[model samples]
Target: MTADTSVRFREFKMPDVGEGLTEAEILSWYVKPGDTVTDGQVVCEVETAKAAVELPIPYDGVVHELRFGEGTTVDVGTSIITIDVAPGSGPAEEPAAAEPPAASVPTPTAPAEEAEEKPKGRQPVLVGYGVAESSTKRRPRKQAAPSPEQSAAAAIQAEMNGHGAAPAAPQDRTRPLAKPPVRKLAKDLGIDLATVTPTGPDGIITREDVHAAAAPAPAPAAEAVPAPAPAPEAALVTAGARETRVPIKGVRKATAAAMVGSAFTAPHVTEFVTVDVTRTMKLVEELKADKDMAGLRVNPLLLIAKALLVAIRRNPEVNAAWDEAAQEIVLKHYVNLGIAAATPRGLIVPNIKDAQDKTLPELASALGDLVATAREGKTTPAAMQGGTVTITNVGVFGVDTGTPILNPGESAILAVGAIKLQPWVHKGKIKPRQVTTLALSFDHRLVDGELGSKVLADIAAVLEQPKRLITWA
Candidate 1:
């Protein structure tokens, strides 16, 4: 029942951006110490295991401190920024021991064993956060005595100082000034910012400082550390020049894991069909000029999406997920149709919810918006969730067909290959026609070979004879 007399500061702890995600790396900070922040203002951007999210400050205050620099991975419920809320307070006069502002809700009484409460002034969290355990509670640390090596170093330093040798004054170890890119480089290399010797003007930490810290430590006593003998012309090490390494994280990491799980867990059966889409191509041009579809995206993908939707309606079993835990097939009545879009970060399939209910124009609009958002790296986690079926157009890349893997959880994914004018027999005569190959890969556990073949055939039939869409719908 005692009142908190410490400096009033609101500690903005990291939230669970996605279900059960424990940590996120700070991408960039929009606010720094001495900057004023308002309620619901985006203070920083963070990249979680799933997606990049902008965290909004929940209350109005002046930023007292940024607990961790950009690129640091902070755990959920851990304070990342402290903001002073008192009317006259400022970052310039921030208290040495600025505690988090306590909650107005009273601490409930509990048994003696559970009486120890969490540290006061902890940031409020959503219900998804796991209950704090004993290990989560901060404990005081007792300093350990120096070891023999450290004692010897101290003696040597004292002897040198007694002889008028200048002592190295401890450098300021407050927040280090570095760009986010430089900080990320340091983090990736496992270099500690505090240990790095800065050479940049204004004492700011630079990318060179971080990389220099990661360089091999100098050899002690050239005599003791013998250099390796030079390699002969036959034993060269130029393999590194031809190879490149990229850190797999974010979308790439998630996609890799999902694809591996899907490939091994699901019994995949892919069926390929080559179709003449000359009629479908003509329809695409017609729809583009239609007033109803004006300002809406009109493309083969849109009609292909509609065709798939119709096929799903005819064979609802194709739009299902294999629930391994439940030992059942979950047939989704509503389709969240995912379109695989490849971005610089990686490939992501963001779906349009209840796509079956959307008319051609509406579906086109949603697809256009989804693609644009994904290209700009602004797609939300919700947009990528609960996908029932997916379409991947490898055709755009000028590649002929590919046996595309089924997206995780989804029963089927259709890959559209490049459409080219190829000689084909029409009405018993060889003529140049728009031809493309479509490959539909599905999980055999949920979709049988007969069902997968029917779905693939349905899509091809609809594309070959565009009038089937009107008749089928």
Candidate 2:
């Protein structure tokens, strides 16, 4: 019996790990061809626009082949790997030789058992992402026979191009091998997919290939007769090496898009206040030594966060989002407090869910976990969503203050500056006091000047007098 008659192959497509994510770049592969894998085993780590996610194989199998290599950005719903489920029955067939020049057109061939058991709706592949409906509905393209004259011309052209013979005309290819997203991209750029050459695995057109096609062709020189001139040693060494170019993707790319959208969409109104945080600093030290907060990460940021929460509680209207589609102000009853942390990948704000209900000790623990996970690059996409308000501390970098932008869909963001012992007015006299500046940027469309001012004032008051946390709450 042949290998195909005994072996069963299953192809795993790239999943949309994050909500509405169209693509992901494979960061690394844990298993390769011929490696035995179990159900729920993580086979590859991929970096989506939101965060890095590990994809787990849904069933036990021996790896048949990996379609794409590491660092390849594959579209969601495109098959990335093939697995041989019944490898023990017989030798697995090599699929590379059977692949067509246009790889986008996949044949709808599945094991009889799989076809019978296939779900009507989407099938779950990864834990959270279900297989797209279109992934399993591929149909073979119908090839039209070429005329005798066309075949003769192709033969002549192939010979003249140094090839002895050719099977089909270059223009005889069926539909261009591109995923739906790639097709849409080409359509948006006004570039025909037929004019682009595919470099993706199995000769499928990629997003890069489309962009390359869309780029304007350089003008041909009218008269090119001059010979090359010798360059100086310094010029030769430094020519075309002035700048370093880095491809923006993953979390950095997401952050950039979000920031741009938030900046432009939201009507920003920033209010600043320099306050004496002497009591807040003292409270932080006391909390660190307290038995209730033992073994927890307690710092000035914790107290600052607590202070901000108390302020929001006092001015509940400030904790809301403007819904453009509905044309309404959506006031949030519960707070998901976002804390901005700078990581190697980029700046990410992972919020604590229902933060308004967490106790001081619980808040400290949550903050600790959030910071630790972010530093290790283990933060998930879910952790970064649904934030009502955000706080960014530039104090760690010894910066005074900055007007922080609001996180998209959120109403306000607070910026905390460095706390330094400076000369200040205390009890009608100049004295060395711990002071810091706070800047609050809010969506002016919903939060008015009075509402924004009250929120900022309340936070400043809480920091100046540590007892107000208990008093205000």
Candidate 3:
């Protein structure tokens, strides 16, 4: 057998792991160059904006090259690896044979543009697939005709303004190159893509470029004009060299954007109640020893979650979402209970599907699996979607309570405070009892103050009595 071999490299581009997610950060690689790999073998794990997922190579081949390193964030449709499917099939003396086929390979843009003409079968999924075809076509924006003299004047003005030559006429330049996610982001930030500088590979505008464009530029210092005074000591934090700046991307970035949108877009009203949860705490201990829930997670949170579900059952309207676009209140017949969990990546709310129907032990098991998966960064993007309502247990951190923010698209969120033994008047006697504060934050657009108060009261009532779960539910 000859030691010399010819290489046939097949490039595998990054796929859209989630709906409209433009990019993913390569967390780790499982296969290296020269390693033998079979079809459906996982080659790497990448973290998208939603969740971390393992990507499998769809074809059998030897790993040829890794285009990007670990921790590198790659735009969707960009090639991240190449595999030599026909490794050692040709002799070294026939190296010229490989060159012709390599040269014949079409550019990524051509295949994407012509994909609709191709007879579509079962397209390869995950990592190995190219970009998915858009179902609808967009007509290019009409550009006004410009005279040669006007164009010359514009170019001269652009150069005088230190912007270099004016940008090519709209008809002369191809549409700004950006992926769907980047385009969506630019839209959300109210930025015109043409005005933003492209810093990505091959003149593609990236999320960072959009964000940079969205940020307010510093005012040019002038000797004739006095600078505005700095605001206060609190605002001076940005002036220090000790500050650490973290680039927001992935899950953290998504969370931050979602929270900001939720805060400003939704009218939030929070109702708080301090109640004696002595009975609830006792029930939690009893459930921990129960044979049915022997191995299941039985904590104050489990009971708190059950209580919130009961409250939603009594006030079913509070489980609804406000549809701003449709101008209607969407009443959910089923409840997907989101539990706010702080993970190393960021805060994630992975909900239990159809949680209102689950038994106590079943709900406990579901909660246990959800938490375990989130902590391990294995929660799927689907797991975090379609939540009707949410519960945030700040109590676990020994905090009193918090005005929890409603998760985007959800109507309400319940925040549980620390359970502590405190002196309280019970049966007209001052004695120590387990007490906790519960704060319910809801969107006032759908849930009014009266409805919000009723829900909060019902939750407190459940914890106080600990028997209402059966009666109310």
Candidate 4:
């Protein structure tokens, strides 16, 4: 075979590993050009806003080309890799294959528009045979053959001396081209897409461009501006010997945006309580020995989570959200308890759905699975949605307490602080007891001081007397 033998090239578009996620950063490639790969081999790892996932090749093939490099954020449905399915037996080439382009292929436009017409059965999926009808996928909605008014005018003009009416000009010159995810980000940040300058491959407004637009143009030396998520840092730390600027992306970016929105939009009120949790700590040990709880994760966090659930049952009004659009206070009948976990990437709150329905042992098992999945960087975006309340255990970091910020949309969040043996008044006597601080932050718009205080007090009461879990629950 000739060295220049050509074969069929299959382009693999970036899959939406997380449902509806528009873009992902190409972390690394496992195979280079000409490398042999099996059908199920993982070709690359990409980080979506929710989590990092390994993408596997769907068929046996030889790597042909990589369209994007590491650290580049590519939109879903955009080709990221190409493969040669028939390596040795060269396929017939196009008649004009000998000719080359004058320059690089025109940077592709955002594919989100035409994708709306595609049926779900035909679109590319994570782990299956993708119907490879990609060549005709970019078809635009055909305009009904030119209106009759134009045809009549064309006949009159042809009679006057013109052969036919001049073709109508293309109608899409003014629309700003942006992927769906970028557009969603713009909407969330209250940015006008057309006003933002384009820095993407083909005049497409990217997520970064939208963030920059939010910050606005730079000012003179005397003035500075506070930028939003995924934008450059306002101030740099220059004191260190070696400075490394890591561009914020993925989970960290989403967390920053949520925190900023929650901080500014919600009316926050916090209350703190210090309590003796010695009996609760002792119960943890006892549960560990129970055969029903054997092999499950029995830790301080497990009990804390159960206590918060019990409190929610006692004070149901605290488990609610403020809906700005409908201008209503939405109370949740079920609890999706969010656990704020610190991982290598950043802070992610993956909540347990219908947590109130679980038994103590079941909750412990679920908690173990959630933490393990998070630590492995495998938490799906679905696991992080629809949380009714949250518990942030800052105790693991040895901090006393904090005015914890309420998770966006949720009315309340409980911050569990470090547990220490401190001198306390136990039954009218000073004694060393296992004591801890609990801070509860709530949305004042929905949860008043009385309701927030009741919820926090209930949790503290349950910890003080472990028997309350049976009565209150």
lDDT of 1 by residue, 394-432 (tens): 999999899989898999999999999999999999999
Give Cα-based local distance difference scores for all models. Answer: 0.74, 0.77, 0.75, 0.74
lDDT per residue, candidate 3, 1-473, as tens digits? 64333435566789998888999987766654445677888888888998888888987876655666555688888777767677656422322344322432232221112212222332222233343322222223246788999889988999998988858532322245565456546644546666779998657789999889868752221111011242344422232247544568889999999999999999999989999999988888888888989889889888888888898888899989888788888999999999999986799999999999999999999999999999877898989989999999998899999998889999999998999999999999999999999999999989999999999999899999989888876
Pairs with backbone N, CA or C atoms under 3 Å apart (clashes), candidate 3 = none
Q: What TM-score, over all chains together, does every model reach?
A: 0.71, 0.71, 0.68, 0.67
Q: 91-176 in candidate 2: lDDT tens per residue?
A: 44455444421366233222222222222443223222323332222122346899999889988988998877766433332235
RMSD of each: 11.6, 13.2, 15.2, 15.8
Model 2, stretches more than 4 Å misplaced? 3-7, 95-240
What TM value does model 2 have? 0.71
Question: Which consecutive 10 residues in model 1 have the weakest lDDT in total?
Answer: 218-227
Lowest summed lDDT over 10 consecutive residues: which window, candidate 4? 219-228
lDDT of 1 at 421: 98
Cα lDDT tens digits, model 4, 389-425, are: 9999999889999999988889999999999999999
For model 4, give the RMSD to the true fold: 15.8
Most accurate candidate by TM-score: 1
**Structure candidate 1, residue pairs in collision:** none
